[model samples]
Target: MTTTVNQVMTSYYDAYNSEDPDRLAAVLDDSVILRSAAGTGQGLPGYLDTYRTMITTFVDRMTPQRIEADGDTATVSIVNTLTARADVPDFMGMKLKAGETLTLNLRGRYKVRDGRISEIDIELA
Candidate 1:
């Protein structure tokens, strides 16, 4: 059986929300590229490093408001909430004290191939 684009995206979100790096990695192609406000990352190692940094610095959650897929491409509108685990003087140009929460509306474009995510581009909505 083949995984649909929706399924791949669902798995990605689930893995992200669960804060499980291994599971997240499982759904991503080794050569995946990620572009977001933080920066661009190529390959699994780069992605993992970014993931670890964010996860360690804050408690993050993504709520998808809408998802649309065509062929192997998908776009998702999401409401992301991040609570500072500790004081952050500078985080993507934002400062937060411990327990402070930041919410952002974002759009994520994804390309999946062979049941894994090959590329992702995230931008402010």
Candidate 2:
């Protein structure tokens, strides 16, 4: 059985909320690529580091407001509320420290292949 792109994204949010490494890896493919304003990462290791930062620095929540899918690709509009528990390093060129909180409007474009996320691009709005 294969999952839809939306399903993959839902699992991604769930994994992030849970802060479980294994669960995070389970939602992606071996060849996944993650791109954002901060940097680009190829494969699981690359993505894992980004997730690690979130796991360590901030207690965050990603809420999807809109989702549009066609075939193997999808676009998601999201609201991310983040509260820093530690000094978060160089996020989009800014340094964030504990006690800082912000809500960001962001979008993510996803590509799914074989029931796993193959690629994702995130941008701020």
In terms of lDDT, the best-performing candidate is 1
TM-score, cand. 1: 0.97
Error of 1 at 104 (Å): 0.5
lDDT of candidate 1 over 1-125, digit per residue (tens): 99999999889999998888998999999999999987788999899888888899899899888999999999999999999999999987989999999999999999999999999999999
lDDT of 2 by residue, 11-103 (tens): 887887887978988988998999888788899987888888776788888888988999999899999988889877766667888878878
Candidate 2 weakest ten by summed lDDT = 86-95
Clashing pairs in 1: none
- The parts of candidate 1 lying over 4 Å away from their true place are none
* Cα-lDDT of candidate 2: 0.85
Give me the runs in candidate 2 sitting further than 4 Å from their true place: 88-90, 93-95
